[model samples]
Target: MESSVFFENSEKKKKAIGIIHRVYLSQLKNSRKYLASTKTKSEIRGGGRKPWKQKGTGRARAGSIRSPLFVGGGVIFGPKPRLVYKKINKKERKLATISALFLKEKQLVLVNENEFLNFDQIETKLICQLLSKFELEEQKKILFILPKPNKKFWLSSRNLKNVEVTTVTCLNLKQLLKASHIILSKESFDLIKLTYGQQ
Candidate 1:
């Protein structure tokens, strides 16, 4: 799609770099699952019995087998499940998304929505042919923005490792930044302009 007039201001372009970086980092941080967990000494099982007598054993005074120093022991300061969140202002996020779109304008392709409709049968080759027509067959990552979900289109594109399909409402900063090429249906492009361009 053509670059939006909203992004034409040189001053805005200059400031977009910092905003985009901040939003990208915020989205990345917020997406983390943070599910790593390690057992502490008290939490470890089978540590109830002392390894040996404290003084009589030839080896050094013994404690529970689950001591951190032991072979199969509890971790001292291992990672625990926790949340990491970074919040960005609504306006800032919108600006960052717009900036990302502006940066990727050259890689953007606008297609009529009808071209993706009336699939007689689901086929991966059809999607491949569509990409070939756009000269994006070799592109590593392509993002498809649809006005709404299309099961046939989604199914046809799912097998491709490098293609992603998302609606305008579900679009996010990370996806926008990571995509090497973005394909937008005419309706989807208009929706994005309506949502992110007025400001």
Candidate 2:
């Protein structure tokens, strides 16, 4: 089958294919970098004064309550939150997104345009039935992309553990690449073409 609309014209997709690993690893590293760490010594409370006399006790030299050797002591060499944002060139970011999009093209499922011109009304039963019809019921992870925010559809799919709903404008590489199946509303498909293909 032919490649998706975004990949139809330029060598952008080819460029993306060449640097997939660099982009993906950059993403993976950045994802873990920003998360706050729990065991920092400063965050731990109460390491005030020396516990006992230093020499008379004949035990390990007593130190402040925060000594690492003590029971309630502060952590030693624990992790702390640090800057983790990786900067990729704008063109590279776009290329990586397009690359991921093209890679996932075969798994893309575009809603039938004839069934519903505007799928504004979110009905759980109807959505579930559609899932069955599309043979997506068994998929472990599915992403629902809409042209814009639809409170109704988002609420409807909120209960499905394996499904997520988002608009084309807010598409993120992490979320896009993580899903096993991508169900794009007709409007979303059009928006994606306009947004990425134009570049």
Candidate 3:
């Protein structure tokens, strides 16, 4: 079906969230880049002159071989800097976000419109209050998307590793999938739509 439903042009029923779990999930999978096979050379530790002649020594061999003499010999195979970002179908990525939007409609997501002011303390109590009021206290993994985090907000939430925070522009494909609850500011959501959605 058509996906160009603008706020002004959307019909009553068409102004609804779309749910396509498999399409969403497949998109996420396609974006993952596996690096298990990367190889890297070890840094040089030491390599001295030959201990003895090639055949005069009683050892395995008498040579100026760096690999044999140095404890930090070059690794046979190790991880190296390789392309970590995999490709995802554009249609699939859009559809996945549509699915997330569907979840958002069902009280699964929280959008904070107000700007954070007092954040000197571990604003867990304030965030807890916000979530409790929405009956979302039980939801553990909450993802917060912002244009950029205010220092106070970052400090307040940094202690809680489960509460992930990221920029709207730098949203993590993996974290989005794992988060039970997705929280975005009004400005952040608008920014996302502006960047990836229709104009």
Q: Write the per-residue lDDT of candidate 3 for residues 69-125, one digit (tens) a residue.
A: 444445565655455544566755664554444335433454556645445566766
Residue 175, model 3, lDDT: 68
Q: Tens-digit lDDT track for model 1 on 1-199?
A: 4354656777877789889998888888898899999999889888899988888667987679989889888999999999988878988988888778878888789888876675557898988988898888645899988888788889998899999989887788888888999998778878887888655
Reference-based TM-score, model 2: 0.69
Candidate that would win on lDDT: 1
lDDT-superior candidate, 1 or 3: 1
Q: Between which residue pairs do clashes occur in model 2?
A: 47-66
Better of 2 and 3 by TM-score: 2
> Pairs clashing in candidate 1?
none
**Which regions of candidate 3 deviate over 4 angstroms?**
1-61, 65-108, 115-122
Winner on TM-score (1 vs 2): 1
Give the runs in model 1 whose Cα sits over 4 Å from its true position: 1-5, 47-73
Measured against the true structure, the TM-scores of the candidates, in listed sequence, are 0.80, 0.69, 0.53
Question: How many clashes does the backbone of model 3 have?
Answer: 0
For all candidates, what are the clash counts? Answer: 0, 1, 0
Q: Candidate 3 vs. truth: CA RMSD?
A: 7.5
Report, for every candidate in turn, its global Cα lDDT versus the true structure. 0.83, 0.72, 0.57
